[model samples]
Target chain A: MGKVLMKGNEVLAEAAVHADCRYYFGYPITPQSELVAYMARRLPEVGGLFLQAESEIAAINMVYGAASTGVRVMTSSSSPGFSLKQEGISYLVGSELPAVIVNIVRGGPGLGNIQPAQSDYFQVTKGGGHGDYHIPVLAPSTLQEIVDLTMDAFDIADKYRSPVIIMGDGMLGQMMEPVEFKEKVESKQFDKSWATTGTRGDGGPKIITSLELDADSLEKRNTLLQKKFAEMKEQEVRYETYCTEDADYIIVAYGTVARIAMNAINKARETGLKIGLIRPISLWPFPEKPFEETRKRVKGYISVEMSAGQMIEDVRLAVNGHAPVDFYGRTGGVVPTQEEIYEKIITVAGGLKYEHENGI
Target chain B: MLQEIIIAGFGGQGVMSMGQLIAYAGMIEEKNVSWLPSYGPEQRGGTANCAVVVSDQQVGSPLVSNPSAVIVLNNPSFDKFEPKVRPGGLLISNSSLVARKSEREDIKVIDIRATDLANELGNSRITNMILLGAFIEYSKFLSENSIIESLKKVLSEDKYHLIDINKRALRKGAELVAVF
Candidate 1:
């Protein structure tokens, strides 16, 4: 694969085409609007369907309709629009549908700035839509990963028969990077046996619904879904580790903040901090194994994120009280620089204990 | 490795399209690449920027602060980014955008009237292509043949004959900057 520069949003759109994604339904949203624009122009060239639905709700439902046919389908939105898609996402999960949903997050508790923000951390990881279901989430920091992960999302969704989200912030979506679209893998088609397509002579049309009125049957399906999710946790944890072997501080972060932490670790290495970074490439499965390993040697851990502190809880859970856990962050679309992270490292390592003062 | 760059300008000036072309060249040369634009609210009314990075190493941080090189199409961008260029980097400024004299002596500054050249060529939209031409020539990471091949690949499908003009724009920019 050769280098071609593309915006993160545009790359997702192009990769979707290359992945043989047949249907795309999305509304215009900041930081992710380019994705829809790219799909609008390119989908027709590939003989695919691209629809700008009336609303985010309609868009996600459109994706639901398309995914039911067992074809590659996708929808993307920014923070607020993504919020609107949650209901559909829950439905997608309940139905065990395979679809790729993208959340190019922006600053917000509600309708925040258009700039980048990871505030949707809990919303995305804790199941933003509803119910007790978990969605497979991939957090990409760079543009290359955006393309790679979009294609991977489709694969993971199908493998688990669930909705997979490539959760990126505005910065990741808006930034451009040189990405080589390698010879695309052959689009793996499903058996259509379980798809809601009209049945053959053996049975009538298959009904695809999230609702299971039968209590026993719903439990059985939930058990199956839970089993699939458990399998994903074992098989689908993705992370990147930098200079942790002899490090005293292990900084844990994911998505965009993780990139900055890596840079901070590099800078701190020169100053003899012996800092390392554990970046969760896959946020939901949450990459617990590495943190469990690093907890023994590392003196303390700080979970850095753009949001107030969402993934920090997962880090503490992963470490299981083995090491001192702390949290430091900036919200409302402010990206913490390497210097800020370095300062936090010093603060955490300097015996400043992180008591659970704020419950959230 | 991936090198990403953001090329920004107003909508009609072809800044965004040129970004796509440069990225395409990079792809033809077999490097991992992505092209992102400032869309929605930010891009609706005002300056537009496209980030482009071409690199031989796996791209880690895609947000380019102090870019390797800057091709400024207007004064606001020049004022905004002139000081940010790393030492010994090229600052390709469209003379129309940057009328102010450069204060830095260490950096290479090429003043090209890309819009004027495009107007002279009977199409103002080719300025971005011209700038891309200069970028390719100065950078040398991508060759003319590869760029042309990529151009043909992007343009041939549309049966558009205007690629010859874009090729001319690319060559002129390359020729103007070769001696510098």
Candidate 2:
């Protein structure tokens, strides 16, 4: 099929439908409203269900209910709205329900502004709700990636029977770009034999609840969940490397910020500087392998983000004092300009060289 | 080569559509394109703007801080964005609403009376199309034919009746640039 010009939010909605996700629940939030609006209009035509719940809290619970029925379900919101959905998300996690949740993030501490931001990094990757578990998080930088990830999110959620979060910022949700939707992949066959789809034929009644009241049983369940998370960590780490070989410095960023960092990298390269970029595709898995491998060769790492240094802590943990890790970011709904990033790269690179010469 | 442009105007002046059309035309030409609008509270009834980037290679940032060209449809937009154009960049302004000329000596500025021409053409809404026509002619980033074809796709079928006037307005804007 030919490529079509589409907004990122609208394309994400279309991709979800193409992925055979027949149920969607969401509330209205800036930047992410287009996704809900698109679903409201398109889902009904495809024999699917689209519901706008009274609030984000209700929307996520609806997703939980639908997912428990062994059907593909999804919900999306921005920062504040997403915070409201946290309780339901934790329940979905504890219940082992498969669902796709999208957070087209905006700046916030409390209704900060309606602009793109990466402030939700810690909130999302660290398990927002009260739980001893982790959800696989996918951050997409481009519109095409958004479509591909939205489709894959459903499968990923079903594969582990866990909710997968697709994280994007306001820019990704609002921008328009050319995208070609691929032919749908053959749906993966998941074992829904244990689903709570009513005790009709063969299997007897099955209960779908996260309430383990007993301490011993809860601990056992927690151990098993930990095992699943470990398995995911081993199998699901994904990242993209650009111009990292023989580089003096590496810039780590994700989502919209990564794209801007690419511009900085290219600019620095034009000035005969060796700068590279490591874009984390999966935030939960948090591709640490790149940093571990590149730490010895590079002088330092620059963690660029739209927040005030949340992901930098992850980079520091990965680096483990092998090299100095610097942070450059903008908060409160402001995006760092390309020139600003490039200047930082030059200053950091020069500072690293000076420190090496002085043996500091 | 990468061409970054900022199209700015009042809320109802179709500033966003102008950027979308340019980006779509670039895509039709098989180039990488991105269009990002200023989608804040100010978009309701205030000055609106969008940034468009077209390149043969992958476009890194969709936000254009320093643009290669700018299209301003109002006095406020012209005053705000005229200084942000690169030294050797191009500026296309709607002279009908904006009475003052850009004072920048480094950049090339082309003033087209798009609103007046659109009024003469019996439709004031196509002022953006006229300014877009001038922008394309001045910048030559995308072929005129490609832009016209893109318009056919961007406009809904019910709105196809106005295609003729839009085309005329585009051509008129281009002619104004040529004469200058």
Candidate 3:
């Protein structure tokens, strides 16, 4: 198909449609409202369902109901809206229903501002809901990547029979770029025989419930979920490395921050600094393997983000004391510039020599 | 090659559309393009801006800090972004609205009477098209034909009638800049 310039949120909505996702339920929220608006206009054209729930809570529940019917379903919201849907998300996970939840994140501790932010990193990757469960989180850096990952999110959600989160910031949601909607992604289809799609002609009525009053049954369920999570960690760690072959310093970032870090890395390299970047595409399965491999060659690591420092904790854990990890970030809707990131890298690289000389 | 531009103006001045046009034209020319608008509560009646990046390679950041070029339509926008233009960059200002001229010695500043030209074309809203015309002429980032084609795509079918006036504004702006 020919390339069409589209906003990030609109492209994601289109990608979901192209991926055969028919059921969409969402509440209006800034940064992500366009996704819902696009779905509202386009889904009906394909004889698909588009619903705008009264609230984020109601919307996520609709996703749960639709997903249980063996239909490709999704719900989108911003940071606060995502928080409202956390309970529903947990229920979806516990019930083992496959659904795609998109969080086009805006700044927040609570109604902070309506601007792009990566502050929801912890909320997304560490299970925002109250329960022992994990959702595969995909963080896309570019508009095209958002389209590709939105399609992949559905397949991944269906593959594991779990809820998948597409974590993007307001920047990713609003920016417009050229995109080509290719053919639907071909993947192994999940067996929906277990789905609660009514008992007419089926062997028995499928029960889709997250409630387990028995302790032993609940423990077993937890064990099975943990096993699936471990499998995902082994199988689904997506990341990208730039100019790390002979680099002494590596900056780790994700989503929009990763793109800015790339520009900083390029600028630093021009000044003879051996700087590289590690961008985590799959934020949940945090691409720890790359850090393990690069720890030997790299001097230190810098974690840059739009938040104060959320992903830096993961970076430090991944580096495992092999290298000193520093962080540079902006909080409350402030985006860091490449020049600021470049300066931070230079300062961090300078400190590395001091630490070596002190030997303590 | 990468061309990073910032288009700034009042809310209803079509600043966002101007940025979108450049980005769409870049796409038609087979280049990677990203257009990011300054979105928030301030988007209503306040100073609005958008960053447009056209590159042969994938654009890293949609936000342009020190842009290679800046198009300012009003006084506040000109004041805010004039100093942010990179050295040896281009600054296209609407002289009819922004009374002050950019004092930057390093960058090339071209002041076009975009609003006045659009008014002469019988539509004041096409002032953005006039500024876009001057930008294309000064930068040569995209062809005039490509921009006209992009306008057809960007404008809705109902607004197709305004295309002729917009094209005229674009040409007049280009010709005005050519005289200098």
Candidate 4:
């Protein structure tokens, strides 16, 4: 494959076009501002529309509006901005619209920091927007995955008839990498069955609304969505395991933090610590199978992240108390160093006896 | 084993391009590779950095923390990253941009005025190309022929004519450094 150097933001924009997304509505936010800038330059060239909405709220609603017509549509924003769009996101999820949302996260409980931070882990995976619904979240650590997964996310969203989110930290958005675009997939077979296109066949007028009067019917719809989510766990869960079979300790992380953790794992191996990494590419599915397998062999586990320790909860749940799990992080946009992780691994090795008590 | 590196500098100095060429050379040598950069805010008006990982096996991480080597094009970058290099590693700094030297004597330092050399050669834009020359000369990271052959694949079509000048720049830097 020929590799062309491209920024992650630009690549995602290109991926959007490749996915046949004809409408994009977004506002400028740190780390992800370039996605909009890229779409502004590219959308017109591909006979698409790029709208700079007034706010994240307006942008997401615009996505809602475009998605109603069953056209591929997308929007992207950073963490705090993403918070503002939650109301609209919940609506999209409830209404079951096929749209792509990108969260190139910056640090924040509220406007934290802009440098790369994975603090939005709980926010993205646990339905940060609102309601009891889930948006399929894909976490890409590299620029190429940022492009490829974005293409996949569009299809996944369309297949499930729901909103899909490509969630990542600032590092993924800001980094440029060599990426080769897939030969454009022509998704000409549009399903107009539920779309708000002009009425056809036996219908006088079709309505698409989240408001249901019957509780049982609503419960059934929600149950169906839950089943779809279960299917996602079966069909879409993805992760990469490095040296877990021989690992004494497995460092679990996602997005940029996972990339750094791999380097630390390599360094630790030199010092005779058999540390490997469990990088979750699909953050929501959580990749329970691999973690469950790794827990059988590894002495202990460490949750490495850019946040305080969000994904550790999920890691603990996946491992099911089979082994001990610990946490290490640098918050407020600071990333953990290889040295820091090495120290933690050494500590875990030194205190291996503590594994039975609290998982060193 | 794969070694990842981040080379940072001001725009127009070809830092990102230099990193790309190194990563591309690794690909040409049949090694798995990735070249990544901080482009949006960092590449616009301030400093720019690209992370390049070259590996014999599948690359798990594309970001570099303790790189085997670092190519610093300006003072801010040198001051920022010099402390982060692994012991006994290589740090190539642009002498024109820095007034201070590396603190660690164990880490080999090659001081080349790549900016000045590129200016003399017609465009300061190729300073990164000149530094890329030093990087190859000192490290033996890739064969000279391999680099020359891969330049066209990395550079844009309009900029392809400058390949000869860059090769010359690489050779000049190699001739100056006795890293071998």
TM-score of each: 0.81, 0.98, 0.97, 0.88
Q: Could you report the DockQ of all the candidates, in the order they appear?
A: 0.33, 0.90, 0.88, 0.38
lDDT of each: 0.81, 0.91, 0.90, 0.82
Per-residue CA lDDT of candidate 3, range A175-269, in tens?
99898887654655778887787788748668999999999999999999999999999999999999988989999999988998888889889
The root-mean-square deviation over C-alpha atoms between each candidate and the true structure, in angstroms, is 4.4, 1.8, 1.8, 3.3
lDDT of 2 by residue, A204-228 (tens): 7888889999999999999999999
lDDT of 4: 0.82
Fnat of model 4, as a fraction: 0.42
Query: Which tens-of-lDDT digit does each residue in A1-360 have in candidate 1?
Result: 666656678888888887778789999988889899999999998899899999999999998898888988999999999999999999999988899999999989788878888998888889997788888889988776777888888888888788998889987887666677888656776566788777677887787899988999989988988898889889999999988899898888888788768766776788777888888999889998888788988877888988888998898889887887778898988778666887777766654544543322
Q: What is the DockQ score, from 0 to 1, of model 3? A: 0.88
Clashes of 4: 0
Per-residue lDDT over A1-360 for candidate 4, one digit per residue giving the tens place of the 0 to 100 score: 466667778888988888888899999999888899999998999899999999999999999999998899999999999888888888888888889999888877787777788888887889876668777789988877887798889888888888988988887786655688867656646465888888867787777778878999989888988998888878888898888878888889888777777777888888787888888888887789988777877777889998888999999999888888888898887768777877888777767434454643
Model 2 chain B poorest 10 in a row by lDDT: B37-46
Native contacts retained, all candidates in order: 0.50, 0.82, 0.80, 0.42
When 3 and 4 are scored with TM-score, the better candidate is 3
**lDDT, candidate 2, at A209:** 87
Candidate 2 per-residue C-alpha lDDT over B1-180 given as tens digits, one digit per residue, 9 for 90 to 100? 799999999999999988988988999999999999988978466999999999999989999999999999999998899889999999999999998898888999898888988999999999999988888887787888888888888889998998898899889888889876
Q: Tell me the tens digit of each residue's lDDT in model 4 across B1-180.
A: 657677988776778778878877887787777776764434455888888878887665566777888889888889888898888888989888877788698788889988788889887777877787788888876887878877887767998888889888888788868743
Best by lDDT: 2
Candidates sorted by TM-score, best first: 2, 3, 4, 1
Tell me the TM-score for chain B of model 4.
Answer: 0.92
